[model samples]
Target: MPVYVRGPKDIPDTVAQASAAASRVLQSIIKGKIIKSIKDMSLEKIETKAKE
Candidate 1:
């Protein structure tokens, strides 16, 4: 899955926050966990799982 980084609403703070978020995502990848895509999950399944 591709990772996406979105900036903050305030233009001045966007770059730093986006960089930090991207760095954190990269660190998670380095730890070997797969990033699951929400688009692949069905709404009913998600709701059921969340209720568990």
Candidate 2:
């Protein structure tokens, strides 16, 4: 997936670090598809898939 981390320079160091961590988690979870945005799917769909 195309993970875009924005405002790293403007935000605090911890914010950038957290964004990197979240990007890693997303990459690890969804390996096949390229997810541009979380809004593409419903929360229920995401929850159901996470269980699997």
Candidate 3:
């Protein structure tokens, strides 16, 4: 069962967001070090890094 929470669904700065995401994914692919874990799906690390 899934519960849906409603809030702001629009992304701010969509182009920048897509570019950043694409870069991350490409880096993972290029390194051939991709693995599955909670960290792989986390945004907090990215957010913190962005804030620095």
Query: Best TM-score goes to which candidate?
Result: 1
Query: Which residue runs does candidate 2 get wrong by more than 4 Å?
Result: 1-11, 32-52
- Candidate 1 lDDT, tens digit per residue, 1-52? 9676964388657888999999987977797443477688889977875574
Q: Which candidate leads the pack in lDDT?
A: 2
Candidate 2's TM-score reads: 0.38
Separate clash counts for every candidate:
0, 0, 0
Off by over 4 Å in 3: 1-12, 35-52
By the lDDT metric, which is better: model 1 or model 2?
Answer: 2
Residue 16 of model 2: what lDDT?
A: 84
Any idea what lDDT model 1 has? 0.73
Give candidate 2's whole-model lDDT: 0.76
Residue range with the least summed lDDT across 10 consecutive positions in model 1? 31-40
lDDT of 3 at 47: 67
Query: Over the stretch 1-52, how does candidate 2's per-residue lDDT look in tens digits?
Result: 8787864465577898898999988886688544567788999988876685
Off by over 4 Å in 1: 1-10, 35-52
Task: State TM-scores per candidate.
Answer: 0.43, 0.38, 0.41
True lDDT of residue 4, candidate 3: 78
